[model samples]
Target: MAARNWKKGSFTGLHGLESALGLFYTRHMFRLAHFSDIHLGPLPAISYRELASKRITGYINWQRNRRLNLDHGIIDRITDDMLAAAPHHIALTGDLVNLALREEIERARLWLESLGPGEKVSVVPGNHDAYVPGALARCRRAWADYMTGDDGRAPTGRTAFPYLRVRDRVALIGVSSARATAPFMASGHFSKAQAKRLGALLDRTAAGGLFRVVMIHHPPVRGATHAAKRLYGIGRFQKIIRKHGAELILHGHTHKPTVHRIEGQNGMSVPVVGVAAAGQALGSAKPPAHYNLFEIEGEPGAWQIRFSRRGITDPHGEIGEVSGALLSPGK
Candidate 1:
């Protein structure tokens, strides 16, 4: 693909992507697919014990509206479309289950296997995955393979907050912002300790001349969500980015396709992108389910990123590329 001449602008038609496919086939580019918020259902039956905690509110919400708003079939379609694109690796930011129930967690494991092997996919937890105090522990055990780092454990070998997996030329760093919160709230927390470890990882990856891609569940950008749903310690997260640069940042809490920029080293700007929920049904209040394909090429300092957003755009349930752009690193 002669992407060198393609200026940073919106892709006007399918022709641009169609023509580039020929060149993409010949070149060895690193293609990464990112999607989140699966919220798989029909939420397995829950008992009174499960409903005694915050799950009570979530269970009510799922019954009243989420059941209709989320469709597992839509997620199936999205995954099929993404796999057809043939990305080298997949990053799932989180919320694979609805209420973090044991059955739901186990079901999510099967769904992950269908996508690809653990080596080809990386994952991080979301607020819903940690809906209650003990839910996250169960998720850790169930999804251990996908969440483990290159060393076969979390980065610290003690906590699972920050994990690293280096693919070809890209380093996938998984961070968790998922935590249990009070009723009527859906916020996430990022502790100073995790931020410290993240900074070191970014530095180490950058030194190794690897393209660093930080994957987290909640958007690190301020004001990205409502007050009750915002990520706590977002400032600390931003501080790390401003000090140590990263090529890209992927997140998925907002359940809306969004693009935000955070300041990076030497005044460069890092792209913080979020995709809509993978299970969002057509005609739902939010945008239909979508996933992002990022083609990363070139070397460490002169890297190039071409990203396309694909998902259901009509009531027919057909998936298509909604938008795309040739992104510049420091823009």
Candidate 2:
């Protein structure tokens, strides 16, 4: 099976391919599993010097609040289920650490490795990953490949925002909204430069008939989060999508499952979805840890995407489907 030769007057991945010398042809179906805000815990020991800056606040927050809500036991169960289901690809939106500490970032990388190789997994930093001024540099050094665009075309080894990855009939656009904020603040932002570049890339990618999915850390819709932790440029982000158009948007940060509708082209509505923290323990304050499994099957124009939201409800519980929705309406 030469796998459909792309060299012939050939075809785009948009079409079904015949393999084994044309004995059979199968339409391609892409399955993507999405989860975010892992906040892998058991934070490293802190020092007085380390707490000299913004980290002191984060350190205290983790010790008092986050550590109790985040449970690795729950996370382990969810990860086991994800691996068992084995989607074709996985996207992690961020918060893979507690304090953006070097040890935390490196540990998160190792956890990502256990999930799969860089090709199978994608990551975008969360606010916690950028909790301090220079922490992003360390994250860039550690998780460069996961953040790289398809074909290694993204800007250097640094974690460049809004890189593009084209797979099958889908274009996964990775964007960074993670930013270091003052103590008691958890927010995200997208620069004007990044917005311009993203608009161009969205137009180009959508022209190729790929289902554009915007990967971001914070929800782009207005009123999606508390004022202190919201995405700074919600209006700008909405304008870009309304102008350029994306079929779907995925984000993390709220740790609550949500499906917000936004305007798309020609009166159609685009779906912006947010998943609860993948490692959070079951509690009254927030939704339980869950990951979304999207079943994407169809050709370029007649695509169908179905969502299955799965979660781990308790420490001794097994993962199960919590709900389902048609990501693409009218079909």
Question: What lDDT score is found at residue 14 in candidate 1?
Answer: 71
> Tens digits of per-residue lDDT for model 1 on 237-286?
99999998898999998999999999998899999999999999888799
Q: In candidate 1, residue 302 scores what lDDT?
A: 82
Tell me each candidate's TM-score.
Answer: 0.90, 0.89
Off by over 4 Å in 1: 1-28, 154-158
- For TM-score, the strongest prediction is 1
C-alpha RMSD for every candidate: 6.6, 5.5
- Model 2, span 29-56: residue lDDT tens: 6788999999888988777888898898
What is the lDDT of every predicted structure here?
Answer: 0.89, 0.82
| Candidate 1 deviation (Cα RMSD) | 6.6
lDDT of 2: 0.82
Residue 182's lDDT within candidate 1 is: 91
Q: What count of clashes does model 2 give?
A: 0
